[model samples]
Target: MHEMSLCENILQTLQQQANAQQYSKVKTIWLEIGELAGVEADALRFSFDSVMQDSIADQARLEIIDIAGQAYCSHCAKNVPIQQRYDACPECGHFPLQIVAGDQMRIKQLEVE
Candidate 1:
């Protein structure tokens, strides 16, 4: 799955951060993954160790925080929680709600040496 490549990207980012921040080792990493970000947490976890092997983050603990999807419903004139991309607004049955959040994945925190 693409989760392998995603892990690679995370490793690359960790390397870049280690260089910039002068950290020699990474003990933990906390990631914020939005529901709509299309990342499978289990798959990413499976790939993390191999991707981080021999890197500064080797054996690092990975923590994923799940973020709920949210969107603004023009018809309802309010924000609502969404599970899928095309979900209708919960209150007004509005189609195609404007996404307000939960479509991104990012590193939230790091514990480094």
Candidate 2:
């Protein structure tokens, strides 16, 4: 899956940060993965272990925070939570809502020494 590549990219970024900051080792990585980000957490975690083998991030602990999908309905003028995309507005049953949240895959924090 694409999670492997994503993990590789994250490791690369972390390596750069560590080298720049002169950190000895990474301890933990806190991540926020939105529901609409289309990333599978378990798959990503597995990929992380696979890709980090023998690397600087091999012992890094991964903490994932899952965020619910949200959308702003133009017709209803309110924010609504959704389980999936293509779900209509909860207030007014409309399609093509402007998504307000839950479309991000970002690193929130890092624990390093």
Candidate 3:
């Protein structure tokens, strides 16, 4: 799964931050993941534990914050919440709403020692 690679990248980032901030351990990781990011949270959690084994973030608690997707509907001339990429505008039932947010995955906060 791509979540394995994503965890690897997270580990790499943690290692780099550890060096820069002079922290020795990571206690908790708070991740902000958008609904449209296409990442499976369960898969990511499993991969994180495997990837962080014996590393600075070993045994770290992971907290995932889900972000709702947002889109602008040209037909309705308003912004609306969306669950999927191809969701139609709720007000006007227009196809292909322009995405305005909820397409990112990032580390929001970290508790380190």
Residue pairs that clash (backbone atoms under 3 angstroms), model 3: none
lDDT of 2 at 21: 92
- Across 1-113, the per-residue lDDT of candidate 3 in tens digits comes to 89999999999999999999999999999999899999999999989998999999999999999999999998888899999988899878998899988888899999998
lDDT of 1 by residue, 35-75 (tens): 98899999999999988888999999999999999999998
**What clash pairs does model 2 have?**
none
Q: Quote model 1's TM-score.
A: 0.95
CA deviation > 4 Å runs, candidate 3: none
| Model 1 residue 113 lDDT score | 100
**Model 2 lDDT tens row, 1-113:** 79998898899999998889989687899999999998999999989887887888887899999989999998988899987877899878999888888888888999988
Clashing pairs for model 1 are none
